[model samples]
Target: MKNSPTAGYHTKSAVLFVVFNRPETTKRVFEAIRIAQPKRLYIVADGPRRDYPGDVEQCKQTRQILSLIDWDCEVKTLLREENAGCKNGVSSAINWFFEQEEEGIILEDDCLPANSFFKFCDTLLEKYRYDTRIRHITGCNLQFGKKWGDASYYFSNRTHVWGWASWRRVWNDYDVNLTKYDGTEVKAQLKNIYNDDFVADAWTNIFNELKAGKINSWAYPLDFCNFFNNGLVIIPNENLVTNIGFKAGATHTVDEESSYANIPLIEIGEITDPVFFVPQKQADLSIINRDFNIEQRRVKHNAWHRKLKRWIKSKLK
Candidate 1:
């Protein structure tokens, strides 16, 4: 990995790398970080499950691989002794990261970011550090081939967390339980943001599932917090991060054929301000139709199958 240093800009930004039992993916992502040569690096790893055989050894190997950080930098480690699962583990790790630093770039083990991703995040983290309107700066561009404008990036309501950066102030308001707002308020807020009843209802169900303890996820709650607060995410015009952890061993991403699995990465240049700070409706709708709608349909299909199975069992009885 060759470092593409932006002119007149040194890599002073702090980076937080979240990892688990995967040493192969961690090694790849670490190479990209090595190129950037950040002054400070924070590593967070969750403890392996005691019930899963070979997990402890794999976890040990992952941490050992991270020790290959040969750059002249200060490294901090937060290794958990007990398994906290994904929802609690990741959210708590992020909370710990923000406690020490004001702002920084965050990357998961599986999200292999381009060398340019570091520069793009470093620029925007300072640019919008005080702007409450913008909450997240994401390295994902799921808009397919569409460029919102001539700017290097655009505002989006969708929270693409593959690779991202944010300030402590924005993260301070993160509620994993969605405890700040009630159901009625959340639905009304989504309705206003999308201006569509069906879309609003669909999202309301997702929040309900989160509240009902049906889904164990950390990213959805962040999206909910940002949307409820009318916060915008900065999305690069070209995708700068690729997800390479969609395999059998993965927890959430099991589908190898996912459209978002191995998206091509492009080098992002210096950050440019968009004409407007508003979320792009066209891009949002495309995401809703392509990602959200497909997931919702899959849920409904599974529900139908379960219902049919119960009916047949009752008839046989």
Candidate 2:
């Protein structure tokens, strides 16, 4: 893997782009991929829902944007004639991709990756291809400013799928039907892993909702599969992908002011071996706190205190 100083860094790995009716974000992400100029590019798109009034037109526009790829590359498309919803659409598209390719980078419409993201994923895809223990390599680094160690990346129990890469060996273990795991047994297993009843109960409740047909998501089930198999994800030292899909018309992201929205992207330098290949307990705990709303509450409380102080100062003036 020699870097060409003139042409810049390019990846030999296949790239999979998952898109639907969001042309605005798709254009931005596609531009980054064009710079990488992957040898093989796979486009997976879901049809517009017949019930939504303007969905069909938007979906068409999004697909039309894909025609901008003017480079000499092998392009394959999997366009659904009918809508498959988010859960089935994304999971099936990924399953189809791994069937033909051993491993590749995956990006959604809103997950805009940095130029280095492709190279980061390509390097790890080959490094851990045979190591079943490391199942996923994610471009998201949610630790804020904290670095787990001197390594360029660290292993995490949490799977961040905003922009990620993985092998067929791990994807083969994906099980959409989570009802097979008994409720009592599943709770016990998660409790052992987290060593906290509250954290385990929170995740168990979400899984129960998914099994009970209350929630529509593809990522959570993949997370469940990873944890159940004792698998780990490679998380970079700095965030490489920014999610810009928290606007209206989105399926799940309706928050106009989400904290995770528009995270800054950082270039990952040369990959270095970590001092240890283990999950950082403190960092994982930070994720759990953020997930359980504890961190959000703390942020709100601090904001309120600042507002109160400003009000008192104005009265004194």
- TM for candidate 2 is 0.89
> TM per model?
0.89, 0.89
Q: Which stretches of candidate 2 lie over 4 Å from their true place?
A: 1-7, 294-317
lDDT scores of the candidates, listed in order: 0.87, 0.86
- After aligning candidate 2 to the native by TM-score, how far in Å is the CA of 20 from where it should be? 0.3
- Encode model 1's per-residue lDDT on 1-317: one tens digit a residue: 53343343345689999999999999888888887888899999989998997889989999995557776778899998788999999999999999999999999999999888888898888888888898999998887778999999999898889999999999999999888777867788898899876578778989999999899999999999888888999999999999988888798998999888888898866677898888997798888878668456767878999999999999999
Candidate 2 per-residue C-alpha lDDT over 1-317 given as tens digits, one digit per residue, 9 for 90 to 100: 43322254688899999999988899988888888888899999899898886889888989986668877789999988789988999999999999999999999999999888888998899988898889999998887888988888998888889999999999989877675575778888886667766677778988899888798999999889987888878999989998889887788878878778888999887998676777775787788887687556567778999999999999999
